[model samples]
Target: MALKAAGGHGGNVHAAARDLRRPIESLLDFSASVNPLGPSPNVLRALDEGMRLIRHYPDPDSVRLRLILASRWKLAPEQFVIANGSTELIDLIPRALGIRSALIVGPTFSEYGSALHRAGAKDRHVRAARQDGYRPPLEEVVDCFRSGRKNGRRPEAVFLCNPNSPTGQACDQNGLTRLLKEVDRFGAWMVLDETFVEYCHELSQLPSVSRYPRLIVLRSFTKFYALPGLRIGYSVSSARTAALLRQYQPPWSVNVLAQRAAEAAIRDQIHARRSRAYLRRERHRFAKALSSLPGLRLFPSRANFLLLELPKPCRAGAVAAELGRRGLLIRDCSLVPGLTPRTIRVAVRSRNDNNRLVAALAKLLR
Candidate 1:
């Protein structure tokens, strides 16, 4: 079977396990790029304590979690809009802002395009070239905003994912700052998705979004906090934009356990620090190991995953299938725009798991 699209996003081991009639844990999943160190103990303890609270509805506004985020970021609580996931906020933006046209930087997250489509908005994609290592052209985007495309009006909004998915490329702070100024000049909204920014904290633009009236910064606890199942995420923007987004979001979109878990997760500075340090060390080692494998070109990544260009004569789908049958699941990039049939993505996992993946590829590729 063809690998499901969206790079077979992490936590898909269940469906594959069911088909193989094996336990999920038996399958080594490297498709999703969650923290290999896993969730903080404090987060798990918070979840256990929150079990009793499930009988009651979650606070419709997620005031407590918002307060934690506000304190951490030094932003007013009014600047926040917590959501079930950043995906919810992505879909809500076009409708909430009544945007008719939007430009998306890609090949990045597929959800941005799908969400805009659902809002009945025009989607314009400017793909980053492989020759450029998939870095988005900030100058070109500024020009697009300043001068409307030949066939259409200027986009009312633009979407960008930092340390972008699938490709694992990110724009530096200087470049992003310049792009924001251009977006401001055009009087359009800029949506910066920083879901993977925790891994590369220095590059995050979270601190400046509140100052930019037309900029919205999206973040998630799923990857960094290892809370994908909880689906906790939020956005930071001007108070007016936050309020508008709130009006469009369903009440209690964030659940009781998720709120409690995230509340505890954010307080564990030790866990966050340790995770950062570990990822830095392990990602380098893992990337080096992947490099030694024949016919695989590993792309530079600041996130928890690496995108690999498979050797010629190797197809992503075929490789994904071969590895899947051996209980190792990876992302096949055939459907991800701007990628070739030989591209595949694998998450940076534990040393043992990473070695197993390398060995599996060694055997397959040889």
Candidate 2:
């Protein structure tokens, strides 16, 4: 039987466990690039405290959580719009902004295109070449905008995932600024997905949202904060834009426990610093080990995962299937647009878990 569909995304541990006929805890999942260190202790405490709030309705505005996020980013509370997850915000964007067409920078997340299609909006793509190490092609995007303007087919918006998914390549702040300026000149909106920016803080453009009237930065507690089960995320933009997006959201879109957990997660500076330092050290060690495997090409990543290209004679689907039989879960990127059949992605997990995956892969590739 086919594995339960994750809608083309990862982190479906439940589905994988059931398909493998094993306990959920028995599987080593390196498919989703969440923090291996896990959520902050404070978050657990907050969740416990928040359990009582479930008896009442969640704050429709998520006021307390927004205030905490505002203080952390030095933006006003009105500039924030909390949602069930960053995916929810992604779905709302085209509808809220009345976007008719968008230019997507790929090979990246599939949801952007899916969300646009659901809104009956046309979408185009400018893919990054593997020869360029999959660095986000911001320059090409600007050129596309300029050329599209001449052809009278300029897109109404641009979707860019910084420290992008699967590939793990990010555009520098300078390049992002230049691209935003070009988008502004074309009178188009820029939807910047900074989902994994916590792993590389310097590249984030969240704090500068107010300066660019058309720029919307999407962030998540799911990745860095290790709160995927909570499904809490938010966007930062000008107050006017935030209001417009809020208009499209249903009442109580964010639940009580998620808001409380996210509020505590953001306030734990010690946990954040420790998590970043641990990942940096562990990722370096893990990458070195994977590099020793013959015929595997490992891509440099600023995020919490590594993308790999298998040696010839090995396909991602086959390797993933073999690993899955051993209760190891990985993302097969063969079907992701702009990627080759050899490409696969794995999360940066704990030392023991990473070592287990490396050993499994070594034996298979040999």
Candidate 3:
């Protein structure tokens, strides 16, 4: 059994964010997943203006941003609840639901478990076999819940990642809806993390949520909008579920600038369209580049990031350390079980940068 220590290292992103405060020009961070062509021109300009409003209490409601989101999504503004970041929202679900027990997709973003741990919940794993392309058997996942229930393990929370982390496979829409309905029958709250869904293009996200009160769809501007530092994301649920979450939402939870930037981003269809086009083209190109490199195992991915399983009997940590020394950073997946040090996750960056990574790996392996 691989040791699952305190997992959420927060990636190099937390480090980069910390380092940025001290002033630096460029940092090659394929460690964090965000849209390479994000925080569009319009939002950058709007942020310049919104920066001045830092003096007043940001509208506690984050009304404008929600309005824009609602308009684009064609949902009621009241249906959207913003947060510090999707992370905050993820953490909140485990909190607000009063769920003392949960299950998460293994080798996924560790924060899901970290949040459950902080909330004093028992976190169980339905490991996604790496050889299986890290695709959890949805049927098995559902069965885990059913069997657990029969065994008196009525877990209240099931956290899912669409275009899931570390391993980029996504459950089809029908599969997700079916899974949700099964879990709902058991009275569990299904938290769907769609942080990478933007990269999936036309994959349908209309969750069982529209008809079921137990489903919640979580999205973040951090990924596709390329605004991780701005810290903005929202949740979609039935009116009742939205209201329940609204009651717990912190006043002015989203700051003035993040709100303005997110509102502007949610409304900028051009940026959204262009980023999708770029990722669709670039992800395939990058994947092909990585596959041709010796000793690298590439998996199928429909997202902006690629989860790579490196040569066996190796420590991914060492690869990461070597890359970091060369000013290039990627995710070392050794900490997550069912994944080994031979596993690394890299984001699809600008074409030149992606080539640089491919070149770096080639040279290192040689």
Top candidate, metric lDDT = 2
Give the per-residue Cα lDDT of candidate 2 at 197: 92
Measured on C-alpha atoms, candidate 3 has an lDDT of 0.79
lDDT of 2 by residue, 122-164 (tens): 9999999999999889999999888887899888999999899
Q: Which ten contiguous residues of candidate 3 have the minimum total lDDT?
A: 1-10
Would you list the clashing residue pairs of candidate 1?
A: none
Estimate, for each residue in 1-366, the C-alpha lDDT of model 3 and write its tens digit.
Answer: 011123744344446545443222355778777888857899998899998999899988887877877777777888878898888887777777788998886658888988898888899888778678777567777887789878998678788888888788888677776888888889888888888888774664644456777888898988899888888888988877777877777777888999888878877888899999999899999999999987889988878889887776557777776776666768777776777757788889999999999998888877
In model 1, the number of clashes is 0
Worst 10 residues of 1 by lDDT: 1-10
Q: Order of candidates by TM-score, top first?
A: 2, 1, 3
For model 1, what is the alpha-carbon lDDT of residue 285? 93
* Candidate 2 all-Cα RMSD: 1.4
TM-score of each: 0.97, 0.98, 0.93
- The parts of candidate 3 lying over 4 Å away from their true place are 1-6, 10-23
lDDT of each: 0.88, 0.91, 0.79
Q: lDDT: which is higher, 2 or 3?
A: 2
